[model samples]
Target chain A: MARLITWCYKNHWMTLTLLFAPLLLHGQVNCLIYDAASGERIACELSLRAIQYRQGSRNSQLLFDKAIEVGPKFAWAYYEKSVPFFKRGLLAEGVSLINKAIDLEPKNYLYYRAYWYFYNRSYAHCIEDLEELYTVHHESFTNTPGGEMEMRMILAMAYAQSGEVEKGIEWAQHLMDTYKEQPHLKGQYDHHILGVLYYLNNRPLMAAAQLEKQLEVNARLADTHYYLGLINRENTNSTLAQLHFKKAWAKLQGEGGGHSPNIFEGFNVSAQDIEGML
Target chain B: MRPVSYLPLIILLLTFSTFACLQSQANHQPKYKIPIVTHDLSYIPFDPLLDDPNFQICDSTKISSGRNRLQYAAGRNTLRSDIVSRFSPQSAYESFNGYIVIRFLANCKGQTGRYRAASLHLDFSPAQAPSNLEQHAKEVVMGLNNWSRATETNANAEYSKFINLKIKNGKIDHVVL
Candidate 1:
């Protein structure tokens, strides 16, 4: 013990890292994670213990698989193991691994799988996962996997993409009504999402109104400008349309148009697109 | 007599307990050093570049996963949209929706290098897109010229990029930049 203290005293930074690695790696000190393996509403202290040693990396991922072998019921290990596969473009392997997590714990991972379907632009597959979560299970997912966007809003967009625009509008309206009391909706674009759908439905007046409200809250998205431009163009207001198009181009230019994870646009506007509009 | 008998029983218990402690100590492996099996190759697989004969990586040593983009003027969105704008759709009305993932290399000389492409259906089952659609998907990416070279300590570096395109109804619907 004296020798260990001496070594730790010599290597202060390494000691600090060793002392606080888990909090640094995940920032989740609490075991609030759910593991559906036991078919009960319970937090996964077991899963946290399963991965108590390390988190995501080549070594960690292999360790996760070992943890799974040691405890086949450890659903979170499967989920953690699956993540790097998705990053490496092995969707087939990724989904297969996540499926083990989902089957073991649907309450936690259904929306995550749906997000992947959305990421892949498999609207039908996305809709299937979401509908099962909602209709069959009577569960409501408030946000996307990483909590960046609303899952119900994604459901609306999926419905819209699959040629059910009216159904999408209904879903969007429901999402807004259900979550209206919660301010910030976890920093998601509620009015912006609804505005895009409203424009798609040819409700130009409502679309314009909703998008204006969106801009009032958050005025940065290039897609919002692009949608507003399209709405203006449809209303035969060429001047406003061109102005909005220019603004959209400027946002793309100014913001560098980087796509953060879990954020998507209905219309991915380009330089030629803005120029053509102008 | 009773005290002597109790003493022998106590000694047997002490010996048994000490043997158990030694056995546990000898058998114990640190919980933290949980043995990992060799990582399964199928789970990780390989980057698409290794299989393609189209282009050789100009330099592999500096290959980064591209956390920093090679900055272009109009930015990532315009770059992606412009690439799609160059596409003359081959399978116009035929419904082929899913993903077109292209992994391409960028060298230190600000040039796009070798590429590998995969087309998948909505469920992520590999898709047999029309020859032209497949050809153009590869061609449009290979055609990219303007790449700002990655820099490491004020020197040029090489990197690879994943161009993940979301296709809907045989058209490029969204590009994840």
Candidate 2:
């Protein structure tokens, strides 16, 4: 009777082990083989890349949701996922996602850089990013060919957009004077900014000439046409103004058959209306 | 009997545990998100006259000069020819006076295929008009037809360059002059 009892106890415990062994192995693999947090972050990054490749906001949102599900702490996923929301004109969601990213990585320059642009709604954030990049690696700006010059131009534009017109103009002029003869930097963004500065200074002819030369080099630039059209319209050259307007319209329509609500509010004349006038 | 009985329970436990772990890990895995970037291209306008089929103009005064009109017609013809030749393949040019009118056709192959002229009215304008005016108009039409056929035959030899021609309301809007 003692031997039977001992055997029975051993058999019962063995049965329990057998019943639970698969669960133990599964838990071990989950803990050891796959790190949930890291996997979620990677998925978020991949989903963002896929969004760019696919050009569909829906796909991006789906991927972003997947990333968040996999890793709730993945800040980059939130940041990347916000892009589609912003693009789809869901500003509220974009703000939330960007805020979430900033919360996760408060000290990260990239997160701050993104927030600065999306929140401030100006080019200042780009300047901030450049400045931060310079701070992190001074040599990247100083030693690299054309890097310093490019950063200066970007800073000038940012300043201009930020309502510091005088400072922007001063920086632009300084760049032009320093790099006037430099083959690599001459006729770059400096010229464009200088043209804008001239227009602001009430020098229409000079502004028109500078913008025209830039347009010649980059015909597809919508902003150049916009400026040129404004100058021409102000000067009472309706034909020239109409030409620029048409060019701008074509470029904007090509983007997706709709004007960018932010930039092209003034020049949103319908094709039929223009034809009627013509 | 004891060893065999124990084997079944061990196998069952291992399989169940593995599945359970997998399910739990799946639940714990975090999700990922993507970032957005926007790239925009600028716009350019296209010429509207290139696609207009009825972009023709006629000059009645020159055609009325009769035999002397040939020189005028010839001059106008040459100018029209030059314009047609210079025009991109996707355009056409037609110029006319009362006594003489010239039409030139350009195709996608960058070849000017046909040149047509009409002088029927030139001989008919006077009370006693020349008998050959009908023949002259006929000749002009024949010449244009022949040229068009030749162009079609040699079209394969030229490089294909496609350009979108803008037409509005079935009319030619602008001439590059």
Best by DockQ: 1
Error of 2 at B162 (Å): 38
Identify the runs in model 2 with alpha carbons over 4 angstroms from their true place: A1-63, A69-75, A102-158, A170-190, A202-209, A220-278, B1-177
The sequence of per-residue lDDT tens digits that candidate 1 reaches over residues A82-190 is 6655654556556767777778777666777787787666778889988888877777544664545568788888888888989988978877876567543423377
lDDT of 2 by residue, A1-278 (tens): 99977876756534444554443221211223335457654665555554564333345556666767667666666666565444432333455566566556544324333332422233545455545544454422221111212444555556666677677667667666755465433432345556776786788888888787766534554556666777888888989988877776675565423232222112223444334433
Candidate 1 lands at a TM-score of 0.65
| Span of 10 residues, lowest total lDDT, candidate 1 chain A | A38-47
- Please give, as one word, the docking class of candidate 2: incorrect
TM-score of each: 0.65, 0.34
Candidate 1, superposed: residue stretches over 4 Å from native: A1-56, A184-187, A232-246, A255-262, B1-63, B66-100, B104-119, B126-146, B149-158, B165-177
